[model samples]
Target: MYERQNQRHVPGHTFSTPELAWAWLRSEQTLIDRGEWTPPATRRQEQEAQAQREAETSTPFGAYARDWIANRTTPRGTPLAPRTVSEYHSYLEGPLADFAGRQLADVSRADVKAWWQRFADKPRYRHHAYAFAKSVYKAAVKDGLLDANPWDIDNAARVVLQTPKTVRATMINDLTPEDVQRVADATQPEQWQALVLLLAWTGLRPGEAFGLQRRDIKTSYIDGIPCWRIHVARAVSRSRTPDGIRVDTIGTPKTPESIRHVWLPPHLVPAMEDHLDRFSQPRAEGLIFPSTNEALPFATTQQVAGTTGKQRRDRTGGKVRPPSGFNGARESIGMPGLRLYDLRHWARRILLSAGMGELAVEQYMGHRLPAVQGAYAVLDPRQVWPVMLRCSDLAGWTPSAAAPAGRDTAVLLNEMTAEQLAAAVSAMSPDQLAVLVPTLSPEALVRLLGTQGRP
Candidate 1:
């Protein structure tokens, strides 16, 4: 039979005989006369619905999850980071494996709940796996493969796991400069001593430090006193290829805010200079903390393509490993649980104690501040210089009496605290006062004269 739809004749199902075709045509015409006629496309749609239902029943969760990850991208339309993709796959194979063999439509809330119990002892893993599964099922719902997501266990994805207070205290609050020095001294081969101190003093993430080149370190003169600054532009990222080869990529820093210039405390500068003199490569572009191996010291992007040079051919070496003796060093210093990252926390504490403001601390630590505040907060070297000097004193690295410009009156004036400044001015001779008077602003001079009972 045939009927017109959208001004085009649409053919219907065929019959074996003329009589059957005639009967079918008559019934369809009656329906049309009564305004109950449905187009042939309705049957086609029913068939399509049946096929979709069948497909949903047969499509395994494992296959769909893999595809989802393979095609996933960030909101900005960039492909997911290699490490993030790897991590999601790990979730699929590990905690999410129970749902893999089951059909996507067959995964019920009960199944999810029962599967979740397996991770009762692993809270962190539970959190990650739940988040991964939730994302996958969310995609399934959007794709019309599932009517509703089965991962509806309340708070399963929103749970926040907190580190124990004792661990937090040890990692941040209880750490001391003496402990930092002890760990630095304990690093094997002595070359890593500078690195240990740098981490504690500058608060650089290990990846950021690893990505540093000689050119990233620059000397700036603040009020005629030479100071050192580290320009953090990139960081080392590690990911595995499909072939299971681990590749190290030197790319942008963790965040845009992480691309910052941090003033190096004077005490830390000497150690950094020493490190450069002894260990840095001849070229400015060469890595400051290159791999210990003589060949392929810096892990370059070329390494990701399995590129090999004569040096690499001599012996295949992996990316730079963590500094040797770190575990033993922490233990030797009576802090068995001390991690390298704890040094970052120690650095933050030192900065705060040295009278650096919250905004300045955040800037120095490469942390993103609130939008309005961040835009207006400028970290000037003049402001940073005094803080660095104070940090040196707080960290027990005060310049010695014999150190160059260490005891110079000009340098001392720059480093003095407000109370110390007042005491020094009170003790100044008339000649010294005369020399300092011209440098004071009008407001300051007026205040000084008024305090001295002068009109």
Candidate 2:
């Protein structure tokens, strides 16, 4: 009970949101309306009986592993992703076979830890081995086969190969405004121009950028100025077949937090418009970067000859190698070793330079953190568009507010976000907020109003 509380793990009764809580209550209400639902009298007895039955017929780890994985389900109640299932099978067969023939109930924390120590040198699969052990033992507890999980040992998670120095070079030396224009000028086939802008300008992951569709782009008002709101809900993934063809899977983003909206600068709209006018399909549902022949919208294939080409060395010695549009663009800009990911790294710096907060940056980057942080602040385009546009403001590319306000500074200030306004108001305290008559975010301003009534 203490362990469960420490992990913040709760049984399926109440959920995080009012909507989910209501749904749960409604479900019980429906069951009660059916006349067959009632509170159980012998809950402990029933649990004890089930446990006794499980103990009577001891199951081996190999067989139990199969059953455990087969029953595993995702958050939305869908079956686990194919890639996830495949990895689980691989771990069971390779690093976790020591307990295969042993009784599932008899497996100890010591055995799981010893197996983890043996595989910790690989670095990549170090955490995976520990995770699999925790999962199997956790499943056993849930299935009434064990009172507690044997694989919750903390020492099992420490990987010997991990080091702070192994990280990539610091992203401090970021791309500049002039550097961006040069790269944009060099992109060929014309369509790649917007692709270049989307990557460098927006902090979207490569897969997220590649998976963008025409319909995902929408326009909305931010601080009374119209801006583009790019809906980022999905990403592209690839898998290689036995016959050697690479297939693309259009799935949900890497995590739930990754499903977010990004605000592109108003000046950048024309570039998107120009790219869509020429490259994107006529229909709204078409991919922005479809294959040349237009058969596969989110994918293209590479031949075996190209895969084993003597002209170059492989990035990962694997399949599904797509031609890079940025590699050629790099030489045109006179900058080499500037990777596609560098653009995203530089974007964070640009936002920070523009006075955007770390929380705002993390939200825009779609970084996964604890669930509580998301509840207080759900950043809409109105809150994040202006922050992102500040970098473009550096280029003197004023398209929206260029005419509305005489000075560019006034235009940008007028475009200050609801969150920014809220934060500013909150920092000013009661005396300052009293003098400021501007209409602010009601959620934040209500507290100020209440404080104004106080001494």
By TM-score, who's the top model here? Answer: 1
| Whole-model lDDT, model 1 | 0.72
Tens-digit lDDT track of model 1 for 225-308: 458988999898777666666667788887778999888877787788888999777698988877665564453322211221
What lDDT would each prediction earn against the true structure?
A: 0.72, 0.62
TM-scores, all candidates, are: 0.74, 0.58
In model 2, the runs with Cα more than 4 Å from the true position are 1-62, 73-83, 93-121, 141-169, 172-193, 219-226, 238-247, 254-257, 291-297, 300-345, 367-373, 378-380, 383-385, 395-455
lDDT (tens digit, per residue) of candidate 2 on 84-179: 666676676667777777887777777766765676567568588668768877777776668878787675566554323223234225457777
C-alpha lDDT (0 to 100) for residue 224 of candidate 1: 39
Off by over 4 Å in 1: 1-59, 75-77, 97-102, 158-167, 221-226, 293-324, 400-455
Which ten-residue region of model 1 has the weakest summed lDDT? Answer: 302-311
